[model samples]
Target: MFKIEVAKMSILFSPITIGGVSLKNRIVMSPMGMNACKAEDGKVTNWHKIHYPSRAVGQVGLIMVEATAVSLDGRTDPDDLGIWEDGQISGLKELVDMVHEQGAKIGIQLCHGGRKSKIPGKIMAPSAIPYDENSIVPEAMTEEEMYEVIAAFKESARRAKQAGFDVLELHAAHGYLINQFLSPLSNKRGDKYGGNLENRYQFLKEVIHEIHKVWDGALFVRISATDYHPEGCSIDDYIVYGSMMKEQGVHFIDCSSGWIVPPNFSERPGPGYQVPFASQMKKEVQIPTGAVGLITSGLQAEKILVEGHADLIFIGQELLRDPYWPKRAAKELNVSIDAPPSYEYIWNK
Candidate 1:
């Protein structure tokens, strides 16, 4: 029955199971930080309550929450969401409940901004390198500081679980903390946390290990597959990292690129510029992967999944432009999507 149903459906509307949780479709609302969380102390607000549920009603299979800092000092900006404290759990749980009420599986992205943090505090990084000449010089993390960040990830995962999230993703991408460690350009340390790729990856690997101790849901890691500069992390580097993550039981690699340092390379942005990264990771690592970056239409998403380039399609800015993009996508793909009971008057028309 399942095989026959899938055969008759557009691949984008097909169901997929990831680490014991099954999604209703392949469309994922990629995590985009909305600086609307009003309280600067890292709490969900009325804006989030309205924002997330609207997308769930549009029928996205999964909705990954914005980059939520694991510590107050780790915020990319003062407005980013946070799960660092037990006090924040109530508001987060409410956010999760609201999304679940609309029948969408929601996940939260746990992160630490590291050198990318704009807060007025001591910033942490694998080494004391600044992102750019104008950026603040970050303090090189002591061995003790490294362990503190790892513990923070673990504790945040615990909070996410308690808040009833269906999935947990570690934000190891962009020019953020974990990405700072992953790229040699940002990390010029001589310790065990620097030098070789193995050392660079150790921070994230240990973070995953700690998160695993507290949470057992679908796990994902968003990575900057390429730093777009020489001697920086490349797709080839991610292939190796993807396999290691697969071995660590990560369900998927959310393949995004650049922003580690000033990008040296430029590609004309079009549909699926980063799909190759996802395809390469899936092909080489034999792990499920998500393709993000400028994926805006149903046919484009369908093509990526059909060609086996990626298991999930992450729609970011497009969704911000239109919260009902999934509904429009279903119409474009000629796939039927049901509206909630309150909006069932479309059938009467």
Candidate 2:
């Protein structure tokens, strides 16, 4: 009788293509917020060491930096990284270079928080739907101002590419600008940018189209599949938007859900909870998609890959809890991931 060792299997060890870049494996490091930039300034700090390159050294296939602002005013916090300034490029260039030196690909999630925008001042959105009454209501952005925001996103992409990022993702999820517009539960307007799903989706189309103008790399949009509100955006709406996004050359969608409006006061999450959204999008749009949210085990991660649920699996808290998650996952699943030369002692041990 022959015994098969799962630890050395090649199934999970396979390389995959994300946009224009090739990943060493299907396991990915999901972007998790550190809120740890240099205090009150958008400077990259020492935290970037343990926060990013550590995961890359562990042989994670692809690493996405936490949502980085495309504009100063678009930032959710003063601590968030920004690409709007020429001075910021050097820091990002260094980070991207470090990740590449480790044999892993690095990407940046370019973002604009829109009306939900926050920092030292107030939150701003397409329309003023107060996130909270005490929270400042966003002033409506005029059409001319809308174009400037779009230009800002394009500039951010150009800077990211210049800074050596391998991929670019438009952060359109979690009730940010794009998702805010998509949700009937949030955006209320009489203009062309609001009303129906098509109108709401128009702003995103323009943004992606323009970003693609200067960015010749892999392009992606992160979208909330279901707004999870009774009168909000639905899966059907996502199908249409997903199809359109694919046409605009969006290589994949980082499928996540439920931040438009909180489901309940107490939202206890379970493992692989949001897999369904990614799975559904993969089935319908027929485009490569990544699944995120509470995917916590090697077996579960492998299952998502094996079952055709998603093209890639993104784990946030799991990676934070263990920077060597990819290495550990490889060992548990019997796959070989090239470990850093400095760790030769471990292999012999």
**Structure candidate 2, residue pairs in collision:** 7-333, 7-334, 7-335, 8-334, 115-124, 115-125
Q: Estimate each model's TM-score.
A: 0.96, 0.94
lDDT of 2 by residue, 256-275 (tens): 88777656535686778778
Model 2: which ten-residue window has the lowest total lDDT? 1-10
Q: Which segments of model 1 are wrong by more than 4 Å?
A: 1-8, 264-267, 347-349
Measured with C-alpha atoms, the lDDT of residue 139 in candidate 2 is 82
lDDT of 1 by residue, 120-195 (tens): 8798888888989999999999999999999999999999999999999999888999999889989888888889
How far does residue 278 in candidate 2 sit from its true spot (Å)?
0.9
Clashing pairs in 1: none
Using TM-score as the measure, the top candidate is 1
* Model 1: lowest-lDDT 10 consecutive positions: 1-10
lDDT of 2 at 37: 76
